[model samples]
Structure formats: C-alpha cells, structure tokens
Target: MRPILSALLLVVAAGAVAQPVAPGQRLDGIAAVVGEQVVLYSEVDALVQQTTQGREAPPDLWSRALDRLVDQRIVIARARQDTTLNVTDDIVSQRVDQQVAQLAAQVGGEPQLVQAYGRSIDEIKVSVREDVRDELLLQQYQGRRMREVKVTPGEVRDWFDRIPESERPEVPELVRVAHIVKIPASDEAGEARVRAFAETLRDSILAEQATIEDLANRYSDDPGNTNRDGTQNGGLYTTLRLTDLEPRFQAAAAAAEPGDISPVFETPFGYHVLRVNSRDGNRISFNHILLQVEVGEDEAEAARETLSVLRDSIQAGTPFEAIARRHSEEPQSAARGGYVSVPQTRQRDLSAEGLGPQWRATIDTLEVGEISEPAPVTLADAEGTQAFHIVLLQKRTPAHPLSVTDDYALLSQYALQEKQNEVLQEWVDDLRETVYVDIRAEQYQPPAGG
Candidate 1:
C-alpha cells in the first residue's frame, strides 16, 4: 500500500477508538465527539506522538491528524449502518499477527518490545488485533463505497500529456539476458563428512543432548533463525523469490516438505544440510548448517580457469544463455538463460529508485548482444547469508521519456487512482453529513484556506 494512504488509515482507525483511561487517571477534556464515540485530548496526544516518533513533524500536525480522524470516524459510523461491510475475526487475527510480528522485529524482539510498551505480549496482541480489525473494516468500507469508480482511456492520456516534460517519467535502459549454470560437486569425503555431522546433530536433538535452539545458535548458517531461538519468526515461512535467496537454496527449499530434512547439498558458497521446520502454503520455514568448502589456492585457480574457459566459449559463438544454463553455478539466473527481469517492472516494484536507477545505469553501459565484465555480486541464501557471484552484464537500454504508446500501463494506473480519489472524497462528504459529529469549539478550526 502507498505510505500516504497507510498513514491516513492509521489516523482514522486509531482516532475513532476511545483510549481506556487508567482507574486512577483524571481526564482533562474531550477533543471531539462523533455520534456516540467521544475523542479525548489524550487520544489526540497519542496520535501526535505516534506520527512524530523518530522524526520531526509539521507544526500543525496534531490539528491535521485530528481532522483526518474526524473524516475517518464519520465514514466508519456510516459503514456500521450499512451492515454489508463486516470484517471477519479470522482476517483481523491474521492482520494483527502480522503487525505484531513486524512491530516485534522492529523493536529487536518480544521482550524488548514488552519493555518499551509497558505491556505484555498478550496485551499488546489484543490491542493490535482491534486496531487491525478497525483498519481492515475501514478499508473494506472505503473500497465498497468507491467500487464504481472508473477512469477512461482519454482521461489517462490527458493526465499523461499534462505531466510537464521536465516532470515526465523517464524510462531507463534495461537488459534481458539468460544463462545455464552447473554447481561444482563437493568431493566424496567432504559430502560424507557433512552428512555425518548432520546425523550427529539430529541424534543429539533426539536424545536431548542439545536443544534445537542450541544447535541453531551454534551451527545454523541462517542468521534469521539464530535470532528467534532457532524458531521461524511469526510462524511465517520464507517465500522463494530468486532475488531474495540463492537459487540453489530456493530450489531445494521449494521442493522440501514440512518436517523434511534434506541431505547435504552443495552450492557455490559451500555445502549445506537443510531441515525444513514447517510449511504453510508456498511459504517454507527451514533451518540449515553450512560448511564452507575450502577452496585452496589450486582450487581457486581451477575455478577461475573454468570460468575463463566458459567466457571464451561464449565469445566463440556459444550462446551466453546456453552456456549459463549448461555450466553456470548461479542457479537463480542461469535457469532463465541468465535473464534478470527489471526490478521496477515487477508487481510490487520495491526497487530503490522505483524502477529508475539500477537498470538505467546498466543500459548505459551494456548492449543487447555484448556481455559485461565479470563483476562481483552477493547472493543471499534462504537464511540470509552473503554468497558471492561473478555477475556478467549481457544486455542494456537507454533512458528516454515515457510516451502514451510505450507507457500506457503506468499512465492507466495514475488515471485510475485519480478517479478513485474523487469518488472517495464524495463518499466521505456524504458520510460526514449522516454521522452526528460535534467538535469542541477550540478544536474545530477549519483549514487556513477554507
């Protein structure tokens, strides 16, 4: 979700709910009242503190937050009257769990989180659960209210054209490449050594010689698991995105089942023995012990020699993609003929520049058929470890301003959002009229322009 919308939702949902005063506490005064719900000064104060936490906020942030809260409460009261927008308990519970886990991770862990908030985990869970439910309910109500919003093609084109040339979207150079990979096998003795080590650890766990937490702390290669006492955080399993994890680890993880322990598997970095702790849908939680395969001077020379030979083969008319698929140890990109899709074009598009930087730089330096110099890159494993990669740039594109013909999808989204916002505002206005809202005279000042 967009950050602006998320903040707006948080303000609305939290503002509408009454904060419980401690038994011995005295109330200063009411801030506002919407229908039967009264907003307290303390509530407004809490919102101000939350909004300003870790950063400086605008001078009128409290007033702005209060206004947003009023708009939200009005809409929420009307939503309750509609009776068609009931958010389920299960959905609320899941959202609550996700938020709680995120909050816990952000604060280091549950114990630290409890200390910071002065609330037990269970208490925090209950509060966060209600907050999630309220937020979800408001979102559902807003979505249903704006269901008929539509943006025409003409509108999209108009918006595209209205964007000033200086402000127009720029398309960066992008490359498309593919490759095949082959990971070198560990020597027989090395494989046997790792297998024996895993068996011993398993036996120890079975015999109560050591706990899973102990083994994970001492030997698990995944740092994420180590922090959680060898447990998967939040009971959520990791999703196998090639970008987020090593290709070999992703492949092995994707294939394993809950409670399945994999035999020693070799990848470019080292040999790993993985144990799948749990699986929920496509998410899999796993523990692993990684043994670094010693690459002595001779071994390093040999591997470099092999890569040089592979590079030569590509130059000698063997397709880079074919060679990558056939011999590259980088499983993630090799299987796709070494093509790494432009990050900005992906669905979520979490790229740092929002699809503007990385590809643009590469496009400037690379050509369609030429390969780039071998560059060192780090590939993260399922447990989040740095595995090295010798990345070759095989493709590139030039930067150009966006056009309607070439950027229709992006323009269409902008058009759709514009239409939705207009409809949502009208809906909110209608709800405000229906809901009985009474703001304290001092707190009811309109915006400066208004």
Candidate 2:
C-alpha cells in the first residue's frame, strides 16, 4: 500500500472518533495541525507502524511519514472547504470493500483474519470504509482542481527525444510460449499408508510420547520447519500460498478451525495431517506432517522419457495446444494452450542470475518454433521436482527504442503521469499557502553554530 493512501485512510477512519483524554493516559504531543485536524504523536506512530509492518524502514521514516500525513490532512481540509468536492457514501463504501477484499485475500480468510488483527470482521470493514472515504475525497478534490490539466503530442515527442540513445527505454526480449504439465497422483494404498502414519503421530502426541514441535521437526514438509522445530514462529503459516501446498493439505488447512486437529489427508505428494493453531482474519497459523511419495528410479526415468516423447510429437506436427489440453497437469496455463506471457524486460543479469539467467539466456537466443531440449528444470511450483518442461518458443520480440506507432500507450501514460505530477505539486504549493502550518523549532535546528 502507498503511504499516501494508508495515511489518508487512517485519518478518515480514526480521525473523526472522539479523543477523550483520560487522566492516566499519556499524550505524545501534537506534531501539526490542519484546520480542525491535528497530527498527534500517537497518530504518527500508528502510521509509521502500519507503513513499516512487513518491511524495513530508514531512521527518518517517522519524520517522512509525519510530513506525508500532514500533507494529506491539508489536502483533505482544503478540499472539504469546497462543498462541491463532498465524497459520496457509495463510492467510499465500494472502495473500502475492494481494499478489504484485497487484504482478506492476503491473509487467508475472514475468520483467520480476525485472530491476526485481534478485531472482528465488522470492525475491520468499518476501518476500511473510513480510510476509503478519505481516499475518494482526496481523489475527488484532485480531479476538481486538475480538471483542465493536459499534455500535447508535441510535448510527448519532445520528452522522448530529450533522452539520449543510451538512456532510451530498451524493449525487453520477451518469449511467448506454452507448456503442458503432468502431475502423477498417489494411489489410494499410498494415501491410506500416510494417514495411518499421521494417526500414529497424533496418538504419540496425545500420549506424551512426543510433542507437536518434535513431530513437526521430523515430519513437516515445510522446509522452514523441517530442520528445526516444525512450528513456524509467530503465526507465519498464513503467509504460505494455497498453491504452494499440496491440494489435500490445502483442503484440510482450509477446513480446520483454530485449535482443531485434522485427520490424515492424502495428496499427490503423499499423506499428511495438520492442526490449526490460530486464526487471524484470512490468515491461519497451522502445523503439519508430510509423508512424501517414494518413486523408484525406473519410474523417474520413465516420466522423463514420457516428456521427451511428448516434446518430439509436438515438434513432429502435433499441435502444442492440443497436447497441452490433453496431458498438461498445470490447470491454469493448460487451458490457455500453455502460453505464458513473458515481460518485455527483466531487471536481473542473464549470465549469472538464478532462474533469471536461464530465462534471459533462453529467450534471447532462441527463435520462433525452436524447442529447447528436455532440460531437467526445477518445477516453478510447490509440487517441486515432479514436473519439468521442454520449452518451444512461439514468438519473440527484439529489443528496440520506443516509437509513437509501437508504444503510444506507454508514451501516453508517461505524459499523463508527468502532467499529474505537475498538478499535484501545484496543489501542494497552493494548500501550503492557504493552510495554517507551524513547524516545531527542533525539526529545523542547524547541526551546530558556525
């Protein structure tokens, strides 16, 4: 989330709430004021915490965050002065719901989410609503103030031409290729065997023969836990993507309630079982045991041979799309005829980067219709080494300089963004002049007297 959006939303939601000072409660002191709105130490602290929740921030982050909050409040206060800029409840509500949905998706599910945030779903919804309302108000104000802002084609061309050849945006060499994935399923006997193992483990835990943590260290499929205590410290299980777990594991995890231990479940990987430790909003903290399926060397060799034959058949005239639809285990891309759209340019170097180097090297050298030999590539999936690919290049675009005919959309976006920045800077300046702003003396003190 952007700092501007986060700060503005916080103000919208929590700003209007009555601040009743209790005798015992400590106050952090006021940082700044915009009209009736006051930026307090507590508010700034909250903003900083939210902004830096999952990431590292610099030492001056709090000061920068405070400045941004002050600016946002100023913008909102100025906008509210114009009665025409009043935001609607419907628009605010819709934006709030969208943001909430996105957050919910990130955490896992609603019940799990409540546990994580220590707040009910309704409370979260209300907070989101308030934040979104302020955001919409700010947007509306921006629109009204910058309605006439425009950039001409000549300006865009000039901007493009100003850049030297070395500085010009380089188009990435992209590959358009499709794939078919086949994941072999574990047999029913295999599943039953894994289930019995889970039940035995569960009995041992119940009987004091072993602890859940000890079992997790020995049996958990999660690499994060397999070597140490099976437990992922501090409810980290929610962060795991559903696609990263075996289908059966995902099903069990999704169905299990906080404190509930699930029976053994079978997946392509083998058999497993899990226990949900806690639920926070959409995120669930859980622990599991993994019984990996054992494949004979011959079986592994046969699977590779099968992929080789499929690759040959495609090269010999079998339609790639038909082959993928019939045999591909990857449900997501198989339906699209195995076409994975590559980005125009990658940031990493091709020669020494991990997957980055391989991708960059392969796409750069291969022409259309050429199929790379069946490479023993790692699966870019949770099922891990079970699936591999023999990539057939479908289309390739060479690197080139930007042009109006070929990159009008990109250039237009750049032009619009430049115009928007100008409008925003002007708005900020105008607000600074109109609003009553006072900076603390300590904020601008010189390092030392000359």
Best by TM-score: 2
User: Considering every candidate listed, which one attains the maximal lDDT?
Assistant: 2
Residue 14, model 1, lDDT: 42
Please give, for residues 367-394, the per-residue lDDT of candidate 1 as tens digits. 5565544432333233322222233555
Clashes (N, CA, C under 3 Å) per candidate: 18, 17
Off-target runs (Cα >4 Å) in candidate 1 are 1-30, 38-62, 105-109, 161-397, 441-450
The lDDT of each candidate is 0.57, 0.60
Q: Lowest summed-lDDT stretch of 10 residues in model 1?
A: 1-10
Model 2, span 110-133: residue lDDT tens: 665565445787788786665576
Off by over 4 Å in 2: 1-30, 38-60, 91-124, 143-149, 157-171, 175-217, 223-395, 400-416, 436-450
Residue 79 in candidate 1, Cα distance off native in Å: 3.2
In candidate 1, residue 289 scores what lDDT?
65
Worst 10 residues of 2 by lDDT: 344-353
